[model samples]
Target chain A: MNLERLGRTAPAVPLLVLGLVCLIFPLLVLLHISLQVRGGYGLGNFIDVFSSGVDRAALGNSLQFALWQAGLCVVLGTPIALALVRLKGRARGVVMSFINVASSFGGPGLAFAFMLLIGTTGVLTTIWSQLFGQAEFPSLGSMIGLNAIMLYVHLPLYLMLSLPSYALLRNEWREAARMSGAGFWRFWRQVGLPTLAPFALGNGLQIFMWSMGAYAIPYVVTTSPASIDLISIEIGRDLESSVFGVERAATLSVILMLLAIAMMWIYRTLQRRGERIL
Target chain B: MSAQTVAPLASTGTTTSNDEADSFLGRWGALILLIGFLGIPLLALLVFSVATAWSGTVLPSGYTAEHWIGALTSSDVLSAVGRSLFLAVAVCVINWILVIPAAYVSVVVEPRIRPWFQALAVVPFALPWIVIAAGMQLTVKEIAPGLFGTVGLLVLTLSGVTFPYLYWAVENSLITNNAKQLSEAARMSGASLPRTLLQVIVPAIRTGVMSGSLLTAASVFGEFPITMTLIGGGYETLPLWTLRMFSGRVPGAGAELAAVSFATFALLFAVSLLITRIDTATKPADPVRPPARIS
Candidate 1:
């Protein structure tokens, strides 16, 4: 097979170098810039990130938003996933295609869709106003509002991500439970939920990381500072503020990167556990 | 409700009349929930795009095709679409050049380092786009100021961000198809290494390559934050154009926004169709369950 010749001829070294330069070097630069203060390297910028009340609030808001978004996505997506697995023929194909399309609805396209449906002067908002004989509907403001919008974007994604795991559920297990006189609820509560917990948790954490790092949707939806403030927006704001804000932006980015790393680590662990169970 | 008490009666039939009713109700209920939640907004967007005016109404007050025509015909919009298409295609090509060799070598020649190489490839997914853009912006400004605000820097940034999709696709294809055996076979038949890779390995994984490129292109087309932050006003992408419509940069641009939204959806739909086609065509005769840990 000429394995040695293949090894000698492969561009392994160049590929490795390209990967490092493309993926790792920018992160290293980010870290380096994050440490810089007053034209010299120091932890002062990170200290500023930790000490500032505004920065702390932004971080808190981001975590809260991500938690709620991930929670809602799981709550709403799991049942749909279960039902989807039960579907057959044309219905399954149509629903699956819809999910695929919806999962791709992120960033600006999704924000625009929601705006058309629920924003001020939005279609649904207008419909609600007419139904109640009111002039205007209440604005979708605050962290809860942001969470709702995020759920719309992320639910299908979670559903698609979790579908494969649900497919792993054996029908024989259900039959066995039913034969043993276990009711449907008991069968699911005792066996189904426990078996699928890792996949659900893993998908939930992935959603958490997704919303945590997301910038575009929040950027488009939340126009006022009085609304929810996320860390992604805060970083963008800082970076655009002034030359000095670059360091502060870097500091916040480093923090955001750390949080993402922590969440991803947990997600990977849960995914591994889920795989082992399967 | 008390299944234990009714166990003897229920044991005679798994699907009793009551159970059939429940299943029917449950299925319809789920369908309604799915459609109402995900389908309605998209439907609204489509309606709005074609409507002449949607202000102060539950539905658009009037219908018109002007916005669709405007979005399709406008020079700025057309240019933005072109730019996005060009950038997406360029990113796909760059990623292909970068990832194909890396994936091929890792899979066929250096199996031991596959894990480490995969970890490196996935780094972009972990880091937030804003953070990467901020850092890349700073780095480019400092090092290659000439390339700043040019398509050249954007090509670089997009390549980094979108590389993982193609890499994973190619790697998965290589592993699942057992490309090494084919490469080895080709080598045994007196084919050189390059010949083996180009003629044997690449063809074997063509589906993966096509799907990966399409996925990469879709992501790049929709990307906004990096384009907005790093190369703002340098080159307007389609997403940026949509953003401008929403921001009221152009007066009475609601119809245009709707058109762009629909267009984006169409693009997304087409990509999904292609992906589905590739998936169905390449599906193994004997299905291989994907390892859970791979994702």
Candidate 2:
């Protein structure tokens, strides 16, 4: 029986090994490069990354981008998610599929969609300047512009993560809260909010993960990356540009991965607490 | 997800009349607002793809098929499309062969390690595209310099990034079809593990596998970053070409770019239909969301 069980599992080993070589080992190589310094391995690269003005600025911008994205999605997505939960059968089906498809779209298609809608001489731009007599449409190359495009991807991603939690919200709970003389906001504050708080945080972390890790939209959107540098941009520059070694890119990548791991750790803590409350 | 998970967000009968109005608006309002927010851009792209000129108007001033013809017939566009298609198809096929057995083993044979399989899929997701690209350059390319800046590398790297989607899709299908019990039955009837999986489990889960493959294909179809950073000067996938067009490299080809964008969307929409059809038709017990215990 043990031999038979081993035979069944054998097919998976090659795939797993391929996954490691293709995905994990390369990452491990980056981690190794990230630690290497002049004449030996140490924290010298990390120190250089921390102290350099440009590197520091890029990391700061990435963190701000991530935090703002998380906050915006949670704030905007809650009402939207709640609204979605209330839809009748047919409408729910339509919107669910729309959200799912929206998440898959990134890179150039999304960039062009944004450009066609909001870029200078774009449809909305052309229309708005005409209607409102405002010639200055929002720039797609600015930090705000970049993040807005980031939301194009991150918002749908957050919805996909958080929408499932709304199923836990029931009409009965609200009805009970009202019967206990609690008003709407009060009920949510006392009960509804608590029930959903962990998930909201979980969803926020998920948004933070994608938002922080995001590269494609930002890469395409920003015209002057120098003024609005993201860590991924820096990493890309170092990887491709001869002025900077691959070490810098590897170091920054490690830092970015660490930030994501930090979020995962926090999520793990929240899940433990959440399991009890839930 | 199950239908009941969408049990309406009802206003209690006791709540004020104002509450009903709020929810009524909120429900339909959300759907319409999202549709308009997301959909108008799509609509505009469609119109622009055929437009002759619309410098400062609410809509296109004129329409023609010239841009569509030019964009579709361009040698650059054709090569990029070929590369993109090859990458998409290859990634989907590679992941298909790899994920099925791995998912079966982790989710069925040894259920305790299911989360590990899931975590593997998600970790790559949380890495920035540049990091993945850099890792590929530093390791994979160095190992085989021949593969550098090739669509072949994109195929291998993308399978790394996208297998998670297929994993979740197929795993959900497997669970929904009760693969463990079905496999046990097949085994008792003298079928080997490979035979049981190939004959019984796969046929049952093909819907998931098909949609999942198509989903990954659509993702690869529009993929940027890795393709651009690694292979930009040496190669030109559809995305790099599109970006070049958008950046005004091609000069007065807005209509062509719009046509290309619209064409891309049409393919994505077509694939989406298959994915959502399964979601709505079979009503999988879980939607496409990532499972719990991770961000």
Candidate 2 — what's its lDDT? 0.75
| Runs with alpha carbons beyond 4 Å of true place in candidate 2 | A1-4, A126-135, A225-227, B1-16, B112-115, B291-295
Q: Pick the candidate with the highest TM-score.
A: 1
* B162-190: candidate 2 lDDT, tens digit per residue: 78878888888899989988988999999
TM-score of each: 0.92, 0.91
lDDT of 2 by residue, A96-179 (tens): 666766665666657777777787777778778777887765566566777777776677777777776677687878776665
Candidate 2 residue-wise lDDT at B111: 72
Docking level for model 1: acceptable
Clashing pairs in 2: B1-B287
lDDT, each prediction = 0.75, 0.75
Give TM-scores of the second chain, every candidate: 0.88, 0.86
Report the lDDT tens digits of candidate 1 across residue range B14-66. Answer: 55635446766886797788789877777877898888778657766788888
| Sliding window of 10 residues with minimal summed lDDT for model 1 chain B | B286-295
What DockQ results do all the predictions give, each relative to the true complex? 0.47, 0.47
Highest DockQ against the true fold, candidate? 1
Chain A only: give the TM-score of model 2.
0.91
